[model samples]
Target: MSPRRSVADTLETRQRILERSLAIASAEGLEGLTIGRLADELGMSKAGLLGHFGTKEGLQLAVVDEAAAVFSREVPERVKQAPSGLRHLRAVCEAWVSYLEREVLPGGCFFTAATTEFDGRDGRVRDALAGMNALWRRDLRIHIRRAMSFGELPGDTDVDQLIYEIVGIMLALNHFLQLEHDAAAPARARKAIRRLLGG
Candidate 1:
C-alpha cells in the first residue's frame, strides 16, 4: 500500500476536490456533478474520490459550503469594513453588485445558480441553500437596523418590507446580467438602491 498521508495532505486533497466541484456546479448545476466525471477530471479513482465524500449529496453540500465561504469573504466581510449604519448598508449593496459584476464564478454567483437549481426540489440541498440565504438576509437586516440605531434611517422604517424590496432588486440585477445580457444592469441596480435607501 502507498504510504499514509499526513493530516495536511488529506485537507489539501479535500480542498482541491471541493474547489473543482464548485466550478462545475457553478457553470452547470449540482446535477451535472458526477463521481465518474470528478474522478476523471481529478485523475483519481472513483473509489479514491469516494474516500473523501461518501455520497454525491455530500459532495454537493460541501460545494455549497465552500461557495458560502467565498461569498462571505467577497461580499459581507468587505462591506463590514465600512462604518456601520446607512453607509454600511450602501456598502453592502455596492459590494454585492460588484461581486456579481466581477464574475467570481461562471454562473455569476454560486448561490444564484444553486437557488434556481434547488428552489423547488426539497432536500438537504434546498435546506443548505436556504440557510445561506437566511444568513445573507439577516446581514442586510442587521445593517438596516444599525442605520436606524445610528439615526441615519427613521425608526418607523419597515425593515421587512425594505429587505423585500432590496432583495427583489438584487434578484433583478442578476436576472438582467445573466438572462438579458444587459450591460447596464449593475449601474441601474446601484441607482435603484440609492433611490430605495434615499442615499
Candidate 2:
C-alpha cells in the first residue's frame, strides 16, 4: 500500500509551489517559470514537483487562480469605506495602484503577464485568462455604475469606457513605477481619475 499524504500536507505543499512559482515568474517573467526551476528553488525533485502539478500549464493555472484570490481579497476592502462616487472611483484606482505598486504578485499582475504572454496563443490558458479579464471588467463596471448612481460622475458616463480608462491608468502606473520607483504614479493616477470624473 502507498503511504498517505495528509490533506493538510498536500495543501501546504501546493501553496508553497504556487507562491514560489509566482515569485519566479514575477522576477523572470512567465517563461522563466518551470517545474525544474521551481523544484530547485523549493529543494524538491522534479518528480516531486510533477507529483503536485502534472504540467507547466497546470502550475500556471494554479498561480493565476491564487492571484485572483489575492486580488479579490485586497482590492475591494480599500474602497469599502469610501462613499460611492468620485471618492469610490478614486479609491478603487488608488487601491489597484497600491496593489501593484506594492508588488503583490511579485510579477506585477499575473493577469497582465498572462494576457501579454498568451494573448495570441490558442488554448485553455488563453480562454481562462480572457474570462478573468472579462470578470475584472464587469467588477469595475459595477463600481462605475454605483459612482454614477451617486451623481459623482456625469450622467452620460459610459461604464465600459470608464473601466477601460481605469485599467489603462493602472497599467500606466505599473510601468511608470517599474521604471522609476521614486515617481508617484498612484497619486498621478488619482489626479487623472479626478479630472476624468470632473471632480
Candidate 3:
C-alpha cells in the first residue's frame, strides 16, 4: 500500500514542488512551464499537479510570488539590516549584483528575465512583475532620499537621474554576468556605484 501523508507532509510536498518549479522557471521563462512538463518532472500526474494549481496562469502567478519572496529575502531584507539612507541604498545596489554573483536564480535574476519576457505582454503575469518592480524602485528611491537626509549625498542631487544611473548599471552588470560570464561584473558595478556616490 502507498504511505499515508500527514498535513505537514502534504504542505511540505507542495512547497517542494513550488521550489523546483521556481528553479525551472528561473531558467525557463514562465511560458516554458506547462502542466504536463511540471507533472512529468515532478513524477506527479497532470491531474495531480493541477490539483495544486488550477491552471498554468495560476502556477505562473504562484511562481512569481515565490520569486518575489526569494528576492525580498535575498536582496531587500538583507539591505534593510544595513545602515539606513545611502548606506542602505548602496547595499540595495550591491545586494542585487551579489544575488546574480551567487546565481540565486539559475538563469540569473528572475525579475530581469521575467521583465524581458513580460514587458510587452499584458496579463496577470505582467501585473505581478510590474508590482514587484515598482516596489523595488520605491525602496531604492526612499533610501536615496534618506541618504540625502543624512547628508551622505548632496542636497541638490537629482534623485531621478541618480536612480536611473544606478538601475542602468545594474542592468549592464546582469548582462555582463549572464551573457558574457564575466567574473568582474560585480566589481565593475561596485566601482561604478562608488563613483556615482562620489566615494
Candidate 4:
C-alpha cells in the first residue's frame, strides 16, 4: 500500500477499536474492559490492539474521550440553534432525556454508567469523568443564569441548587429506564423539569 493508504488504514482500524470499546464499556463498565476480551471480540491480535493503545489505562482514557464526543454530538449540539436562556435550557434538557430514552448507548447513559463505575475510584479515568461532568454542569449554570437575567426564573434562584435538582431528575430517569425498564420515565422527567422551571 502507498504511505497515504497505510495511514488511512491505521486511522480506520483505530476508529473501529474505539467504537467497539465504547459499546462494551457502555454495557459492562470501563473496569470490565480487557485487552484480551477486546482482541477476541474484534478479531485483532493482542499485539495489534496493544499497538493502538500501549496500556489498558490508555485505552480506557481514549474510550472516555470518545464517549464525551458522542454525548456532545447527541445532546448539546442538537440544541445549538435554540435561543439561549430558558428556551435553550429546556431544549438541551429535552435533548438529554431523549438521548437516554432512545437508548443511544445499550446501557443507557454512558456518563451515568461511568460515574457509577468510577465515582469512588482515584485515577485518570475518574478524573476525566469528573471533568466531563463538571463541564456539563457549567453549561447548565450558564443557561440558568441567563434565564434568570431574562426574568424567566426568579432572581433569587440558587443556580447550584437548581442544577443539582435538574441533574437529579436525569439520574433518576436513567435509573428507572435501566433498572425498572419504566416506559414512563422520560415523560415523568420532562414533567418534573417543566414544573421545576415553573412552566
In terms of lDDT, the poorest run of 10 residues in model 3 is: 1-10
Q: Tens digit of lDDT per residue, candidate 3, span 120-181?
A: 99999999999988887887788889999999999999988997898899888888988899
Where model 2 places Cα greater than 4 Å from the true spot, the runs are: 1-5, 81-86, 180-182
What does candidate 2's lDDT look like per residue over 125-196, in tens digits?
Answer: 788889888988887787778877887777898777777787888778777776577467778877887767
Candidate 4 at 103: error in angstroms? 0.4
lDDT of 1 by residue, 1-199 (tens): 3346676787898999998999889889888999999999999999989899899999999999999998888888886668889998998888989988887877777888889999999999899999999988898899999999899999999999999999888888888988888999999999999998877
Cα-based RMSD of candidate 1: 2.0
The local distance difference test score of each candidate is 0.89, 0.77, 0.86, 0.94
Predicted model with the maximum TM-score = 4
Q: Would you give me the overall lDDT of model 2?
A: 0.77
TM-scores of the models, in the order given: 0.93, 0.88, 0.92, 0.97
User: Which pairs of residues collide in candidate 3?
Assistant: none
Tens digits of per-residue lDDT, candidate 4, 32-111, equal 88999999999999999989989999999999999999999999999999998999999999999999999988988889
Per model, how many backbone clashes are there?
0, 1, 0, 0
What is candidate 1's TM-score against the reference? Answer: 0.93
List runs of model 3 lying over 4 Å from the truth.
1-5
Best by lDDT: 4
- Candidates ranked by TM-score: 4, 1, 3, 2
